[model samples]
Target: MTDIKTPKTWRSPAVDIYETEAGLTLIAELPGVERDALDLAFDRGTLTLEGRSDDIGYQRRFRIPEHLDAEEIAAELKDGLLTVTLPRAAGARARKIEVTVH
Candidate 1:
């Protein structure tokens, strides 16, 4: 019998999303992925992340909210963990209103 090789499959990395008054934050666990191999992009209202290392790779996508600023998005990778921060637009941020007692 001849040996047959199967194609490798790519799996979505584990991710955690949090929303705060300032903006949204996404944390993904990508073990074995190198810092230079990661890619981040925001277009229209969609956010995507992809990276690869050896036989393991990660891919994930999210729909960004209208309040968030796509141009100001930033990302950092450390200790196999990727952290992406999306800041809220100037007008979208929450403002505290002072109360006056007469």
Candidate 2:
């Protein structure tokens, strides 16, 4: 009798998203993936990431917040990790206003 207790494989890529006062950050783990193999696209309010590593391929899509500035999207790949930064839109940036004393 063979013991079949191995964990099931997952088909989706591993990713993490974080939101801060200044912007939103996305991190993805892509082992064996070359920098040139990665592809990123943003349309409307959606951000998509697709890539292939070794024999594995991955695709992920995220719904970006309206407060985020899609024009300032930036990405970096280092140590098998991809980091993307999306700055908040102009209206989302924090501001201070003074009230006139009566």
Candidate 3:
């Protein structure tokens, strides 16, 4: 008997979304994925992540809030984990209010 391998279908990776005063952060677990095989996109208010590997393939999408800065989003991948950070827009960040005593 000979060993045979079948093609795998795309799957949804495990993800965690966090929101704070600084902004929103998305963390995804994608083992055995290469840096060049990963694809990320942010258009309008949606963010997409896709990766293909010999054994696994996954893709996921997220809707970003309007108050966040879409253009300056940052992404980093290490140890099979992907971290994406979306910083809040300048106007959307919380600011201290000053009171004038007359």
Best candidate (score: lDDT) = 3
For all predicted structures, in order, the TM-scores are 0.85, 0.83, 0.89
- lDDT score, candidate 1, position 75: 91
Q: Over the stretch 1-102, how does candidate 3's per-residue lDDT look in tens digits?
A: 112233287889999999999999999998977788888999878999988767668799998989999888999999889999999999999999999999
Root-mean-square deviation per candidate: 6.3, 8.4, 5.5
Q: What is the RMSD of candidate 2?
A: 8.4
TM-score of 3: 0.89
Tens digits of per-residue lDDT, candidate 2, 1-102, equal 122233233246799889888898999997766777777899988998877764567678999988888899999989989999999998989889989998
User: For candidate 2, what is the lDDT?
Assistant: 0.81
Task: Choose 2 or 3, whichever is better by TM-score.
Answer: 3
**What's the C-alpha lDDT at position 96 in model 1?**
92
TM accuracy, model 1: 0.85
lDDT by residue (tens digit), candidate 1, 22-74: 89889999987776777788877999888877666678889898988888999
All models: lDDT?
Answer: 0.83, 0.81, 0.87
